[model samples]
Target: MITEQKPLHSGYGPESTAQEIVSDQDLRGKTAIVTGGHGGIGLETTRALVGAGATVIVGARSVDRAREILASLPNVEVIRLDLMDPNSVEAFAKAFMNSGRALDLLILNAGVSFPPELKDARGFDTHFATNYLGHFQLTLRLWEALKRSGNARVVALSSIGHMIGPIDFDDLHFNKRPYDKNISYGESKTACSLFAVELDRRGQEYGVRAFAVHPGAILSGLVRHLSNEDLAEWGVTRNVDGTYTSSGGFKTVEQGAATSVWCAVSPMLNGMGGVYCEDCDIAEVVSADSQLQYGVRPWAIDPTSAKKLWDISVELLNIQKDTIPNVGTNLDSDRLLNVSIEEPVVNGQLSFTR
Candidate 1:
């Protein structure tokens, strides 16, 4: 478990925009890659990073489309990357690695929800493959480039949906169990958090840090697959003029991308890693029964589960374990057997203390 999963009381809140977070930060020589960077929350993130002087490479499945969308952003490059296709992922990684440019930030921002039921070529659930495994492979494939930076941060865009449940390892692809779209999405997001936990543990020694961010709920391209009825259930209202209004605590795209930007550039987070964040601050660890929709759940940050998932991912990706540096060979049996989390009341408030 991440012992430091507690809020920093960062002055920024739900309304803070990504642009606001990075407005004064200087990233002049940094290099960043944002998956799905040309659209929605990712587009705002890319804009903010570029505005701060970082040269960003936007990875999109459609190169021309991405270029058209990002043509106005200076210092932003569009590259072909289809997260659902392993071959495409490999090709993209190879191209980036061949450039020999160190990677300073990697934002795994692309994801899907409520899409038609499907599977990738490997027969894995499309949700799991694209949202978690794809980013998992990309991070490992670019490990060398990340290491070259001597100070790199990888942000996995998880969600409050992670509170839905932990990864169902026994039936990750819903092979043996009945498939529920919401459950599948939740599990995939949980995997994103677990990936951050394990990646931070392994990568920290090599100057790489990882964070999982729950960009607040927003009406963005991610909701394209949903019907008007679905949006209505989520508290979206149609105006007289036909413009949609989000009233269920939904944020603007800029606000939605704020946590990712804060994770990437905030000096307040300089020494922290492997923690889940929200609203531009480290999130508290909440119990599964908690009604609050903001904090991270214990299952998402369990070190044992994190490592187990990491190994499973490596096997699924067919990557040689030896190729990855600092891959832990043994798991502490005590830690595995006795995973305990305690929340203490401090100043009349529920505070998680690991």
Candidate 2:
């Protein structure tokens, strides 16, 4: 069933911090994987989850950097995983699954915005590839671990940037059109939202649920590429005196992580999935002014678009996996879409134990 895309009036708001949400929750034996878990709001998310007693594996492209950021944090392990590299992603997943641990929480919290480049090793657009495809491949690779947990929750860190536009499937790599950083970021984020919906549709029956979250606008490393002029344009509404004030609705790192943490461990959301959440609550649909800032837009959660993006991603991955004939992937999306891809391209011989 589609979860109602409306707020439950969660007692939390934009000012709520990650620690405040999980204060009373005990996650003693829970195991989680947080991509990009070393910096920005991702760091706060890791802190809160670990504080609640969950053993978290931080997937990082730079193991040294992750170690530096998470230095001495108990129950947190830093592993080398690059979202832009498929080989790295597969290797990380195989290592994790073969370790005999079930993943109870998978947070797709790492993403980039306004990158200076257009493509990666595979010639795919970096924003779309990193933000959406990397997470897609990782989740599929770890499906069995999530299923075995019997109560897994996958959270995708979507953004209000999704309101900027929906995805243009044909031009995902900017092959035909000119590349605009803002539009590309928006496309990647929209894909993130769609992935959650489709993932929940397929995984809910296996006791796994997925949700997409808009963490609200926060000053983080995420906007590294935004020039002062770009920042100025974005801050036209708020009093931008060299920094973001509360009037701009910008959140601190702690405040930004509230919704992601909420979606990951909230009992109030039990049995609900495929919803877009903000401010620590399931958001409402935008029914009035198109300029509404809070509610989820119609295009972001459209089931058809979600499935379409899923198909396109599978097709793209199938093509990318073509080079790796040494390993095979368990493309078991067949359960939901009746499309079976036993493509022999993964580096490991691991199987998805459906």
The candidate that wins on lDDT is 1
TM-score of each: 0.89, 0.87
Query: lDDT score of model 2?
Result: 0.81
Clash totals for all candidate models: 0, 1
Whole-model Cα lDDT per candidate? Answer: 0.82, 0.81
* lDDT of residue 198 for candidate 2: 90
RMSD of each: 10.4, 6.7
What TM-score would candidate 2 get against the native? 0.87
Worst 10 residues of 2 by lDDT: 345-354
Estimate, for each residue in 266-354, the C-alpha lDDT of model 1 and write its tens digit. Answer: 98988679999999999999898777888998999999999999899878877655565563233221122111222211122110000
Regions more than 4 Å wrong, model 1: 1-3, 237-243, 327-354
Could you tell me which residue pairs clash in candidate 1?
none
- Alpha carbon lDDT at 350, candidate 2: 14
